[model samples]
Target: MILIRLESKGPIFYYSYRVGMGYKIFKFYKFRSMHTDADQMVEQLKHLNQYANDEAQTIKTKPLTRSIIAYSNHDHILVKDDELFEESEYEQFKALEDKKAFVKINNDPRITRVGKFIRNTSIDELPQLFNILIGDMSLVGNRPLPLYEAEKLTTDKTVGRFLAPAGLTGLWQVTERGKAGMSAESRCDLDIEYALKHNFWMDMKILFKTPLAALQHENV
Candidate 1:
């Protein structure tokens, strides 16, 4: 936290909305690693993100896409269409449409000086344990999806993976760790695999192999 404070001007910890099992929305946090203006930089690097080009990741599906927002209170209000919204709400709706899945970048420019060290050392993720303790996640399961990613994952094939718990270390992270050119498709496939086959014994095996990744979330 002190190191982060030295290099960053915003909150020392940054939490974003993540979707867990049953499509539960909760705050997922890490040590602040990106620049305060990182949100503003998304458009600049949008083209570099794998999901930016993935049509499969963007198509509006049920449940998640039907979610509406009360901007004043920032609460989710479920309603079907945008025709019922105010003009300002419609603009925000378009903004949400523009969002793509979160992608992990290599040597991303948005990372601050301290950010790289924390991320590389997995210090940025220590806060995830708190989420686990709070029952927002579990010991071994799927990586929770960010809001943008979860919104599109409501598709039939991808949605079933949410049946698995969200976790700090899971089959996908350990299995795919350090592998070259890991694609979003492969990771999501692993999540589905775990969802279908996971059990106590498999969870134990996954925990044993997590050390292979040095406890990193595949940091790709």
Candidate 2:
């Protein structure tokens, strides 16, 4: 069994994870990165996320036929409705449509100011070192998923990702780091691949590459 405990250090409060049963559980520590009621907020936000997912699926199925028109009071107009957009325009449109599925919100009101800073610098994950030190996790392995995310991967095709220990950093996060519009399926494939092929040398390679990966804007 895995146990999560809340503890306070000075002005900061964080969670500690323990994995085991009976008298043998080991404790792991981390700094808090979210609102204190984040867990409760998840349920409230579930329908909104599901709605976003459905919207994304709908956008994927529909062909891009919508056109935009711009009006100018001057003698000439820069763009016309029927004119075809450049490749970059199409990419931008797709990205905009897909934004709902991946982006938390325009500014993400749920995230505290401190939360944003810690997340951007990867400091939010610093406490997980205790887990690594205690053997509950590794420096390089499949990232631990929240219960909601884990449930979606229970299918036979995706379950292989769980064969390895959870990590502080992993394959997809490094390889796909600044690339936009990655699907959940793609992430699962990378996790499963890492689980199947992970070894001491590969782990060391990942550990070495992690700092550069973390520097990228899209650490998710």
Query: For model 1, how does the per-residue alpha-carbon lDDT over 1-220 read when each residue is reduced to its tens digit?
Result: 8888887799898888999999999999788999888867767876566434344344443433323443354344435553344444544554444344447566678888888777766678889999998999998999898776788777676787899999888998678765656766677789999999999999999999877665453333
lDDT of 2 at 217: 54
In candidate 2, position 85 carries an lDDT of 44
Task: List all candidate RMSDs to the true structure.
Answer: 9.8, 12.6
Query: Model 2: how far is 38 from its true place, Å?
Result: 1.5
**TM-score of model number 2:** 0.63
Candidate 1 whole-model C-alpha lDDT, 0 to 1 = 0.74
Q: Which stretches of candidate 1 lie over 4 Å from their true place?
A: 50-102, 215-220
The 10 consecutive residues of candidate 2 with the worst lDDT sum are: 1-10
RMSD in Å for candidate 1, one decimal? 9.8
lDDT of each: 0.74, 0.58
In candidate 2, stretches whose alpha carbon ends up further than 4 angstroms from where it belongs are 1-11, 16-29, 47-106, 216-220
Collision count for each candidate, in order: 0, 0
Range of the 10 consecutive residues with the lowest summed lDDT in candidate 1: 62-71
